[model samples]
Target chain A: MSFHDREFKKPDFNRISDVIWEVPTSFKQGMRVPAQVFTTKKLLGEMDAHVFDQITNVATLPGIVRAAMCMPDGHSGYGFPIGGVAAMDIENGGVISPGGIGFDINCGMRLLRTDLTWKDVEPKLKQLVNLLYDRVPAGVGSAAFDDAAGFAKLSHGQFREMISSGAEWCVEKGYGWKEDLAVTEEEGNAEGADESRVSDKAVKRGLGQVGTLGSGNHYLEIQVVKKENIFDEEYAKKLGIFPGQVVVMFHCGSRGFGHQVATDYLQLFLSVMESKYGIKILDRELACAPFTSKEGQDYFAAMKCGINFSFANRQMIAHRIREAFAQIFGKDAEALGMRQIYDVAHNTAKLEEYEVDGKKKKLLIHRKGATRSLGPGNPNIPKAYRDIGQPVIIGGSMETGSYLLVGTKGAEEQTFGSTAHGAGRTMSRTRAIREIVGNTRDMPRDKARAIERRKVEELVINPMIKKGIYVKSVSYSGLAEEAGFAYKDIDEVIDATAKADISKPVVRLIPVGNVKG
Target chain B: MTMSYHFVEDVSLADVAFEASGKDLKELFESAGLAVTNTMVRNLASVHTKVTKTVDVEGSDVENLMFNFLQEFVFLKDAERLLFGKIKIDEISEIACKATLYGEKLDSKRHDLSVDVKAITYHMFRVERTREGWQAFVVLDV
Candidate 1:
């Protein structure tokens, strides 16, 4: 049956609290565990029914522990909804699925703070945005660097090293500061990356697209923090966040390299899922293999390579942003205090030790469209922020504001220490395009183009300009698809997480400029 | 018979979904390829058939065959920067197929690129024969 025809009843959910809901294993025939969703009643009511279907599908997967969980910002995705999290027991026939980690292997976000205030950047905001647009190669099929010579300098050997070493490779190559690696997740390097297992095609795609901000929801924003928006004054001050402070936040993934890896593995897993592993799944997109099998290990090793590629990718972008700042401010990046607060991967499956049934067991945790929210006093967090917790960067739409949250111990107990990544989409891209741009399905090509151009100006461009935000994009239609109205309210999404006690808000940021691909 | 394809809205929050139809296996593959290309660029006529690449893919079933066939185009677009607006199936079978893709290198000035499709997803992906023809539903991660 088509997914749209699927209907869910309110009785399917067993309310655990005001913000938490559960779909018991008895709700579905094949489910091995319950599905827990962290969201308010209003958000839950507004969520698409497919989200529940997909998450319930995840609960039925083999070797799932506790429950298949969805964060506050959960929305429908392929096999598992975005913002879905599940942990599998490695010792008990646990399986690894590429869909759980998403196509973009290490799709993530990074936030860099600066000492400058909005006053210092307000006058040059236009020039700064233009310069950044020129320096960073963005848009469809964008390459590594703007200059031909710079792109050519990246040789095959260097590319291999970069994937193996991740952000450290960037630092070694003098692309970023040495201290930058410390604040990154896993020191910006995930171990057990076997580059030999990576297909040649994936490597070729990785070579030229290391430093690009690819299109469709990926962006870089310049933001300001107002004193009233600081919810936790002591914690914000400790993180060097002050009133009127300017920060740079960018969201992207491992680019085509990660996509190719996921593509290759999904194909391979489809063959092994039923034939070799004797595993049955509700959907082909949830294709997987036993973690101990050769196919699974090979995919894990190659996935590590993809993860490293993303780390290196963001590191290079951070370096370029620093360069743009230096050019605009007439000072070195260090002197401008462009310090990286943290870099976290939202799409990944990491092997971690979590308490399960009063025993500390190592589980393979898959977090898609979710961020690692390690609470205060967690030894995994960086030394500088151990007392405060890991910083979770939630990138809202260009028009709406973003949030900076900290992990909580409650998250560790409930969600294996994970939180929502961003304000999930409330509508589909097709709906957004049809709402903003005239419906072009029946119109002639030229007429449709004219209508789209006019509608884009009236809908996306004008609204953003009125909000005092400068946007530089390669495709107007693409920008229109990501308009603020397309996503759920960031404030509401953040509040859900806070009410659920998964994360605590620290500061809110107002956007001043945005660069989209 | 001429290949036919049209975009269809699905429930994905971060993807573009569509359905393609054809009279037979060959036309089905061709229509699916065009659907993916059209998702990337607005106008299919603007992409001239200046270049050709022979694509050979093997799958154990019709669904796998369709998945591999469409994914080859995404790889070509990203790796070679080529966008194919037309396809000719040289041969086809349940387990394997070969085709020649006709398109040109992507030129930003000429092609009005719309969205960057990252990969073809297997979520609710299907290829089936109907009373009149064959059909497939595909979701693209953008």
Candidate 2:
């Protein structure tokens, strides 16, 4: 058995509120602050023990402000738990760590709104899905779409421009509309992206992947807002989301380009961490350098390139999606009212000013598998959404429904304006494979694998089809690993966030069709 | 006979995890490489040996060497769109490893793909010398 296989006991928590649990600094040594978990009693019990260990470790990091926090969907991960949040004071001796911000930088969610309803899309759902599946490449090592439809081939100069400009480059190239950027976080182009800071290897890996949807829980889905599921009708209407209306939501991040950037920086930081800055970490994954150090600034600039790359990636996918719809319905996407609602990144480290100890301070906030939820009246939000707050997209398992939520002021006060990213995994992928396919140890290797494939069809595909949800996947075995049973209840996770007032639910969108990567 | 690799349970909730054991460092590197490749493609046999790539990487220790070695396959997948079904480790020491990877350019039609292994993560990543041989534990960000 491996060291990770060791069972950990849940820690005793002090009740802060119904949805808030706190672990004092006394619970662990070398702690600078307490750890807060925004989850219900039931979810707390279901959380992995490593979450407690990891979050406490996060609290021990230098110059951490207030408390290290985990969203309701928090789960144990390397270094920091997934759905973890930490704010490092820049003026102080704070540090920036790549582990805190996942490898897939800005791996986020995007939603497009359409005026068409279920009645309009139901008839051609399968055709639309198949076209989407073809137009947008999915799964492992997926290259860009055909040259005619994709910007897969680019000169070195052009690649640098795209990485620096992000979705802004797409809009200028006619791949997206100008209005789409307004609703997007950072208007689809994060500030301070320096092409020189990014490595040639990262560029090579990201060059051809602009329009691709990579594998592993990443997907593009057609969903509908059922009339009854609309929670705040006023906010939904403000966001241009109508009951029964169809929308397209997809999740991905800076593909290999981002991975390489994180890897390169982690290696560099690890080399200089002890001798250059004398920072010690409980886990090697928590490698870091002083926020003001040359290494930290370099990584930040390079990371922004990854953030911009994802914005471009999702923007290109949105273009292909619009084309697919237009080809299917024989009407241009504009006439069909294909407008973007919002695009939000769940993994990132951004420098923002927040009131700390009653003084406004600039802090580099790292959100790993957590979404930024800015409340109303924030200047960072677009003009159209300033009064309503940022739109927070929380995707659930494909079988379960996803949600459209709005940021609340409570999030700013309690969580540094952060919220849960998704219905966090409750079971491992291997566990899902075995539990769904049943025992096949006696069967031959190929035969056992075949049974697993068949079980995915019979148990996952067939049932989904019966319920009128059309699915197109590159691999059935990959789809089996994402079975709905492998995740926590989305509704429960949403309830926890709402009760905590970190985010307010707007609409619950059920999947009508899916293109799984 | 020693097992080359086996999927581990109860480690990571979202990503894939596996433990690979070999009688020596060379075998250990081979088994670990296969584990990384196998996580992406369901059947290595489906990826025909149409291409061969020579891999050379160095690290400070066994753990770092293993990390760098496994990353080669991940980098190949993204940089060249290549998949290696077979790994032949010619040399492996505490500080370095040299290997040959044999596979083909990914053809979605022929390859039974599973998930894109985004990167080899250091979370719970370990490599150690055991009583009989060398064993490594790896968790991949899929």
lDDT of each: 0.89, 0.91
How well does candidate 1 score on lDDT at residue A130? 93
Q: What is the lDDT of residue A409 in candidate 2?
A: 95
TM-score of 1: 0.97
lDDT of 2 by residue, A1-517 (tens): 4545766657799999999999999998888999999999999999989899999999999889999999999998888999999999988999999999999999999999998999999999999999999989999978889656447787778989999999999999999899999988999998999989988988888888998999989999999989999988899999999978999999999999999999999989999999989888888889999999999999999999999999999999999999999999999999999999999999999998889999999999999999999999999988888898889999999999899999989999999999999999998888887888876534665786789778999999998998779999998777888889889999999999999999999999999999998
Candidate 1 lDDT by residue in tens digits, A276-387: 8899999888999988789989999999999999999999999899999999999999999999999999999999899988999989999999999999999999999999
For model 1, name the residue pairs that clash: none
DockQ of 1: 0.66
User: How do the residues B100-132 of candidate 1 rate in per-residue lDDT, one tens digit apiece?
Assistant: 999999876677678888999988788988876
DockQ of each: 0.66, 0.72
Distance (Å) between predicted and true CA of A198, model 1? 0.9
Question: Which RMSD does model 2 reach against the true structure?
Answer: 1.4
